[model samples]
Structure formats: C-alpha cells, structure tokens
Target: MLEVCVESVAGIGAAVAGGADRIELCAALAVGGLTPPLSLIRQAASAPIATHLLARPRDGNFRYGAGDAALVAQDITTAAEAGLAGVVIGASDASGRLDADMLAGWVAHARAAGQARGRPLSLTLHRAFDLCPDLFEALETAVHLGFDRILTSGGQPRAADALDTLAALVARADGRIIILPGSGIDTSNVAAILRTGAQEVHASCRSPLGEASEAEQRFGFQNGAALQTDPAKVSALKAMVRRA
Candidate 1:
C-alpha cells in the first residue's frame, strides 16, 4: 500500500486520483508537517480514500510542552469528530526517547473519541521514532502502547539511505506492528524500498507547481513555489508498488 502525504486540497484530489491507498493529511510539509486546520481535516475526510491527520501541534522538535500536549489531544479528538480513518502522532522526551506516557494518553483519548462516534481510530506513531536514541527500544515502546504502525526512516534522514536498518526493523517487527518506511521515497527507489520487506510506503510525490508571485515571496508568506502531488508521479509510484 502507498500512503501519499498531501498538504492541500488539490494534493488530496491528486492523491485520490492517482490511486493512493491512504492519505496523510498535513500542512507545512517543509517544516516536517504540522496539524492541519479543522476545515481541511473535514474536507480531506470527505474524500473516498482513507485519511490520516497529522496531530503535531507545531513543528521544530517532537519534544513538546504541556500546552502542546493539550493541543495534540484536542486535534486527535477533532480528527475523530471529522470521521478520519486515523491520526499520525508522536512525541519524544528530553533525552530524545519515545515518550510512552505522552503517546499513551493521546492514543487513549483518540480511541475514546472514536468509540463515542462508533468507529475505532487507528494510531500511527510518526517519525519521532526516528529521533529516538534506540530504534529497537522505541519500536518496543510503540508496540506496548498499542500503536497500529510506526512511520520511520530507520533512524536515517531517508529510507533509501538506511535500507539495512529498515530491513532490520522490519525483521524485528515480525508483523507485530507495521514499520512504514518514508522520507525521500519515490518511484525511482520505491521498488528497492519495497524489497526491504516493507508492506507499506509513504511519499509526498510533490512537484513544483510554479513560482509564487513576487509579492507573496516578498511578504515571506510562501518560501518557494508551491508544491503539489503530481498525479503522474503518484500513479507511477502506485504502479511500481503493485508490481513489486
């Protein structure tokens, strides 16, 4: 299965049209993604594909404060209300370890919220697992916390750059939980990535739309040109995954 990360409404349409198995709806992918607005969440959930909302309150570091934790909880609840299939969430401690307690609280809250709506929400530990001091330990922690999956790059910046670790993690996982390889994934390298025994993969499949207006750039509103999921890229990636 291919999980396409999309940041805008147009991206969502492209992902769906391109045959994405799932959509990880987020904003500011440049900053490693943040919680999208409630309106966008509702809009993405309306699509036919499964939608998983990123629950990070802000960008920067995965280590968050009490207020930030509160915000994450609220976003998970909001995703449940919006009828999302699931949410991508993660948090690390000061020592760069997976924050089990924090994750437990949010997962419980998300599950409870879903139960109230008569649907069970899926929980995916985001890439914060990549920042953990020990990937194996973190994986164990995630499993203990009842996460449905762990999105990681095997402690590397890109999955292709860490195929060995990714394979190791997959072996250790032993189907106990999904080890989703992401970051720097594309059709060119997805076949090799899938060869690592990853049942699912994630990619932005983004392409530069065009340069932002000079005025918009000058105002520091848009950094570079906008990026959107290229339907062709998505289609090609899906085809490659299916072939593998």
Candidate 2:
C-alpha cells in the first residue's frame, strides 16, 4: 500500500488522484509534521482513500509532557469525531524508551472515542520507535499497545540507507504488526525499499514548487524550501508499489 503523507487539502486531492492507498494527514511538513487543523481533518475524512491523522502536538522531540499529552489526546478525539480511519502517534521518555504509560492513555482515549462512533480506529506507531534504544523490544511494546502498524526507517535517517535493518524488522514483526518503511522513499528507490518485505510504504511525494517569495521568506512564512505534493510522483510511486 502507498501511504502518502500530506499537509494540505490540495495534497489530499493529489493523493486520491494518484491512487494512494492511504493518507497520513499532517501539517508543517518542513519540520517533520504537526497536528493538522480541524478543517483539514474533516475534509480528509471525506477523501476517497483512507485518511489517518498524525496526532503530533508539535515538532521537536517526541517526549511529550502532561500538557502535550492532553493536546494529543484532544487531537485523537477530534480525529475520531471527524470520522477518520485512524490516528498515527508516538511518544518516548528521556532515555529513549517507549513511554508505555503515556501511549496507553492515548490508545485508550482513541479507542473510547472510536467506540462512541461505532468504528474502531486504527492505530499506527509513528517514527518515534526509531528513537528507542532497542527496536525489537519497542516493536513488542507497540504490539502490546494495540497498534496496527509502526512507521519506521529501520532506526536510520532514511529507509533506503538501512535495507538490512528494515528486512530484519519485517522478519521480527512476524505479521503481528506491520513494519511500514518510510522516509526518503520515492520512485527512484522504492523497488529496493520494497525488498524489505514491507507491505506498505510512506512518503511525502513532494516536488519543488519553486522559490519562496522574498516577503514570505523575510516574514518567516516560508522556510528554506518550498514544496508541494506532486500527483505525478505519487502516481509513479504507486505504480512501483504495484509492480513490486
């Protein structure tokens, strides 16, 4: 499955147009991703493809405090109310171990909300798993937490650079959970990434949108680079996934 991470409504259209199997909805793609606005979530829920909200309160580290946890919980509720297919989330303690207590609360919250809506929301353990000291241990923790999948790059900066580790994760998962290889995935290297035996892959599928306006850059509206979801790239990547 081709899970395309998108930051805007236009991206939702592009993903659908390109036949993406799923959408990881978020905001602020430049600094990882942030919680998307309710407006976007509502619209994403209506997309033809399955849309999963990325319930990240902010960028930076995954060590969420009490307040941050509250924010993430609310986002989970919002996504459930919005009729999204699922939520993607993760948290870690200072020592880089999965924060089981914190994650359990969020999972329970999402489950309750989903039950209220008459549909069990799917759960995806985000790349925060990559921060763990031991990935295999972390995988077990996630499965025990009721996560349906884990989005990771084999603890590397990019999945393409860690094919062996990615394969190892797939072997270790043993079908108990999905090992979704993401980060730096595109048509150029998707075939190799698929060799890891991952049933699904995630990518931004972004193409250059030209330079930012001078005023936009000066005012901090635009960061170092400007990009947009490229439907063609998404289509190409989806084709690659099919061939694999």
Candidate 3:
C-alpha cells in the first residue's frame, strides 16, 4: 500500500486521483509535518481513500509536554468527529524514550472518541519512533500500546538508506504490527524497500514549486522553494508498487 503524505488540499486531490491507498494529512512537510487544520481533515475524510491525520502539535522534536498531550487528545477527538479513518500520533520523554504513559492516554482517548462515533479508529505511531533510544524496545512498546502500524525510516533520513535495519525491524515485528517504511521514497527505489518485506511505503510525491513573484519573494518570510504533490508521480509510484 502506498500512503501519500499530503500538506494541502491540492495534494489531497492528486493523491486520491492517483490511486493512493491512504493519505497522511499534515502541514509544513519541510519541518517534518504538523497537525493540519480541521477543515483540511474534514475535506480529506470526504475522499475515498483512508485518511490518517498527523497529530504532532508542533515541529522540531518528538518529546512533548503535558500541554502538548492535551492538544493531541483534542485533535484525536476532532478527527473522530470528522469521520476520519484514523490518526497518526507519537510522543517521547526528555530522555528520548517512548512516553508510554502519555501514549497510553492518547490511545485511550482515540479509542473513546472512535466509540462515540460508533466506529473504531486506526492508530499509527509516527516517525518519532526513530528518535527512541532503542528501536527494538520501542517496537515492543508500540505493540504493547496497541498501535496498529508504525511509520519509520529505520532511524535513517531515507528508507532506501536503511534497507538492512528496516529488514531487521520487519523481521522483528513478525506480524505483531505493521512496519511502514517512509522518507525519501520514490519510484527509483521503492522496489528495494518492498523487497525488505514491508507491506506499506510512504512518500510525499512532491514537485518543486515554481519561482515566486518578485513582490512575494521580497515580502515572504518563507524560503521561496516549496513542494506540492504531483499526481503523475503518485500514479507512477503506485504502478511500480503494483508490479513489485
């Protein structure tokens, strides 16, 4: 399955049109993604593909505070109310270990929210797992916490770059939970990722934005370089995955 990471409504449209199996709805992909607006989550849930909302309240690090956890709970409730397929969530303590207590709370909140809607919501632990001190121990924790899936690059910046570790993690998972390899995945190397025995892969399928207008370039605080999902890229990736 191809899980396309989309930052905007345009990206959502492209992913759905291109046969993506699921959508990881987020914002500010350049900073490793953040929670998207409720309106975007609502719009994405209306689409045909399964939509998983990223629950990170902010960017920079996986270690979250008490207040951050509360915000995550709120987002989960909002996602459930919007009829989303699921939500992607993660948290860590200052020691870079999985915050089991916080994670359990968030999971319980997700479950309760889903029940209120009379449907179960899928739970995915995000790439924050990469920040854990021990990958094997963290995998066990995720399974214990009842996460249905985990999105990781095997602790590397790119899944292709961590083939050996990813394969090891997949073997270690042994069907207890899904190991979804992501980060820098594209048509060029998706076959290699699949060969690691991972059932799912993630990609942004982004194309570079065109040059900004002179006035906008002068006033805009953000770097002009931006990325958006390309439908053709997503389609080609799906075709390659099918062949694999």
Q: Write the per-residue lDDT of candidate 3 for residues 1-244, one digit (tens) a residue.
A: 9999999999999999888999999998989999999888888988898999999999888888778888999999999999999999999888898899999999999999999999999999999999887999999999999999999999988889999999999999999999999999999999999999999999999998786677776887556766889999999999999888
The whole-model lDDT of each prediction reads 0.93, 0.94, 0.93
Instruction: Score candidate 1 by lDDT.
Output: 0.93
lDDT of 3 at 180: 97
Q: Write the per-residue lDDT of candidate 1 for residues 1-244, one digit (tens) a residue.
A: 9999999999999999999999999999999898998889989988999999999888789988899999999998899889999999999999999988998999899889999999999899999999998999999999999999999998999999999999999999999999999999997789889988999999999999999999999999999889889999999999999999
* Residues 14-130, model 2: lDDT tens digits: 999988999999999888899999989989988988899999998899998999999999999999889999999999999999999999999999999999999999999999999
> Candidate 1: where are CA atoms >4 Å away?
none
Residue pairs that clash (backbone atoms under 3 angstroms), model 2: none
Better of 2 and 3 by TM-score: 2
Off by over 4 Å in 3: none
Q: After superposition, how far is residue 80 of candidate 3 from its true place, in Å?
A: 0.4
Instruction: Report each candidate's C-alpha RMSD, comma-separated, in the order given.
Output: 0.8, 0.8, 1.0
Per-candidate clashes come to: 0, 0, 0
Task: State every prediction's TM-score relative to the real structure.
Answer: 0.98, 0.98, 0.97
Clashes of 2: 0
Worst 10 residues of 2 by lDDT: 220-229
